[model samples]
Target: MDKQAALHHFKEHHFTPLLESELDKLEAKFHRCQAGLISDFKQSFRDLCAYILSMQQQGLKEPIGYIHYSFLRTQMLEQSYLYMVEAYSAEWYEDDSDCKLTYDASWAYAPMSAMLENLEQQRKIYMGAINSADVERLILESAPFFHSFVDSLVRLAIAESVQSPEYQAIHKAERLLIRTGEYRDISENLYVWDQEPLRADEVFEQLMQSSEEEPYVYENLKSLSLPHLHQFQKDLRYNDFSYSDLRGSQFHTCILLGTRWQQANVEGGSFQGCLLSDTDFRYCHLKGVNFSEASGRVDRENGLRTPGLCGIRFEHANLDEADFTNVHSFEHAYFEGASMQGTRVPRIYQQHWKLSDSQRESIVWTE
Candidate 1:
């Protein structure tokens, strides 16, 4: 087509609105991609934290565990980019539209790859300077640098002045959406430190304060882990984890005498070999929570029974050899998969228990 003929067609079809509309669509898609990238990155970080916690639980602490993690953030960010923006970039460029315009929208995201690479290099440099054997500290300190990635990843690959005012405005809004509380600032929540992390005592105080403000502190108690606390310390005894979300939290083998876990979501957590004497776990969610070898207020040898687990509902909970000797009213507590061999209960509500033959065989009910 001749230039004159093409110009005429463009003017006749009112191509200006069509172009603007397509640009708006591109902007909207960018936001979706941007949000997805942040989401994926955050989820991956959480999984990493969970994995590290699991290792710590096994009494495995190695210095330079930091070396392994130093390589993750940048790789994870690149993966996020591929999923969020790169996959659709080429598709959008080749799109057949009424305006017959071909847009390499991906060009606006090209600078991000270089930026991520630079970040990785810089991270390696920072990681090298650390002389400490503390793996947690190494990981924690390296984390704040990546917080900027959440803000910078969504920036346009083009020069700001070259962009149209509308494109700039759209980009601004998308960036602001994440910077605001809705997406959550990583430093404020995930890293949760200014220069250094809070001490165990400080974390406890912070959690207790947060508990009072919120109805139930759901899933935000990730910082409550106390690796430094020893079994002999008993420092966190009588801690108030009641009415909080403790799903998947680990308190295995800790001395938690008289701690209140009432109504807390303690599902999938471990209390193996824990001293849970007089702990108020009434109505708490204990599904999949490991209580193997846990002891309560009752000590049949010492005659220290104090009506433990009175009115407690352990329906369907497998108490594998959990010492409930003389626990008052726990005769009514659920003991579905428990091997009650040698474990004694009142047997008062034994008739009301609904158990499979396997379950019944498992529970060696003693009066």
Candidate 2:
């Protein structure tokens, strides 16, 4: 469905009604306990706990559900702190000569404290999953949920007191909404690298034209399909090309120090005679790539050598005919694929230092 239709469906059917109901119940309880009496406060705390538990059970089934639930829980916990602060007033704490007397303090503080801690922990868990998740997937699947979540918060904040602790919760909710909105924007206009609006040759020319002291660095080029890029041999150090498609590209004798190629598609790319020290190739498709004579280790001015293959990963790629001879730390590189047939590889001793069984079997020994 379209964005508006999907958002309307989610808001009307799932996110809006649920959040409004929970917030309404919490607000009603807060209003009833305005006098700050311990009994009334305890009841409100119990109500909050019930809502939290209910959301945990029902609103964490999917990625969108978890994101919505986290946003709401954080807001709820922030509001709950208002009751705790009110409970800790002079009436609750009595200072005697020998000790301080506490009255119904645990009833007002304990549950909310526990719930806040749980809320933070759950938020972390959800955020970790969200970070690892595909941005496009999240935008397509969770955008409606995020939209309704932010809308619910905005509606709730209409009558909320700014000086009150509940306002802090609203502020936090707004920050989260803004972050999600930014993600949505990115998803809406994700660059099509295959379109080649930003060509490697053009970029190289631009870099050559610039007089910056540091080597040119490009970042956030995810999902760019820049195929068949040739003549990339330049000072392209410290560049981030993660999650881009560079299929069948050529990088003959390139200096790729500290470059990040994580999750990039470098299928059939050539990197022959390249300087690849400190380059990250984790989760990349390096099928048939030429790395022969590539210097994975570099001599530094501090009389020490940079690690040769500290973080190279070829976990699940077609390595047929990919050259690895004279590539330092070939032994340290991960190669968890099928056995090499006619591929040129480092010697058995060079491959033995840290090679796994599958990696050992995957290499064809050359002298």
Candidate 3:
């Protein structure tokens, strides 16, 4: 069409509102699409970059371990673009009414979708290139886009494997084992300084000092692991002890949810009256611990699953009225005076239990 005819059409159709509306629609689509893919994508990327640079600055001479790199890579490909476009498209169509406007909107979004998908591909390639040195340079150079990718990948890695043993171990060892960044003892909760071990007496003193109004301690307990604490204890109130020490330390009536005790020592630690639901004790020693009074007192606000007392030598451990609905026990696990109502014991033991006087007295073989 000629300019005059187009101008005439514009006048006839009141194109100003339509143009503004289209522009608004396009801008809104871009924002939504971007937002769906990332929250403050640029800022998150910068943070990721800073994290990487900080790691590199630490001058880590040891070779890094191989991670499931493809997991993060595939996640980026799927999340960084695909579902975002589809989600945003549905959102846009839900509001769009006019056919012409809808057509225009579709066109506008089409280019963006294609562009974003390509951008997502590029992100995959870039992040796939991310290794020890490349990750270091991307972080050091402060590449905003790279930062975005790195940030997403880091988060993705955390999200995907947060519950796995490797992730837990890495997290527990993040600070102490991290080759990046200089060690800073800003908070007693994050670092386990060999030079500044919290002595048993000091721990008791700290626990008893209720009147001094102890200062708030913000420790990055992300890497704080205590897989073998023969007798580690600290005041457990509003303190982030996600990976704190619990090795032979007796935790009494303390609230410890979301605390990281992965592979930490809890051997002989009396957890009487302590709230310890959902706290990781994987691969940790729990032999002969006094959990008789501590079984049912777990903090349930965090929605963690009931923990298994299996592998932890509960020899003569009083578990009266304790909920062992899913706890696995070996044949030798003693249950003298232990409640078996709804407590799952091995099937083989179930037959052997029939021969016992208690089973004979408890069971009535009536036709």
**Per-residue accuracy of model 2 over 1-367 as CA lDDT, tens digit each:** 5545544554455433443444344434433553354344334334433443343346421111111111222233233212111111112123121111111222222333333343334334333432212222322342232233222222122112222343222212111111112221331111112212355556545555533344455333445667876744566664657667888888777777656676788878888777776566756777778887777663422212233313354554556667777776444455554334456785765535455666666567886
Quick one: ranking by lDDT, best first? Answer: 2, 1, 3
Candidate 1 lDDT, 1-367, residue by residue in tens:
5545544443334333333343344334444575455454444434433443444346342211110111123333343322111101112224222111111213223433443343344434333442222222323333332322332332211111113343222211101111111111221111111123335577655444442223222122222344322222133443545455666666655665545554566656667666665454645666555555555543322211222322233433434344433433233234444334433334543575655576556554656
Candidate 3 C-alpha error for residue 257, in Å: 1.8
Candidate 1 lDDT (Cα, 0 to 1)? 0.37
Query: Candidate 3, residues 1-367: lDDT per residue as tens digits?
Result: 5545544443334323333343345434443463344343333333433433344346421112211111112223222321111101112224232111000112222332333333334333333432233322322222222222322223222322334343233212112211111112111222221223344444444445532244223223332444333222333432333334554566655544324444444555665555443333433444445543333222112211123111122322222223222222222233333222223232444552323465334432321
Best by lDDT: 2
User: Candidate 1: where are CA atoms >4 Å away?
Assistant: 1-201, 204-235, 297-367
- For model 2 the local lDDT of residue 32 reads 52
Segments of candidate 2 deviating more than 4 angstroms: 1-214, 298-311, 329-331, 336-342, 348-353
TM-score ranking, high to low: 2, 3, 1
TM agreement with the true structure for every prediction:
0.27, 0.41, 0.30
Off by over 4 Å in 3: 1-51, 54-204, 210-248, 295-367
Residue 62 in model 2: lDDT: 15
Q: Model 3 scores what on Cα lDDT?
A: 0.32
lDDT of each: 0.37, 0.44, 0.32
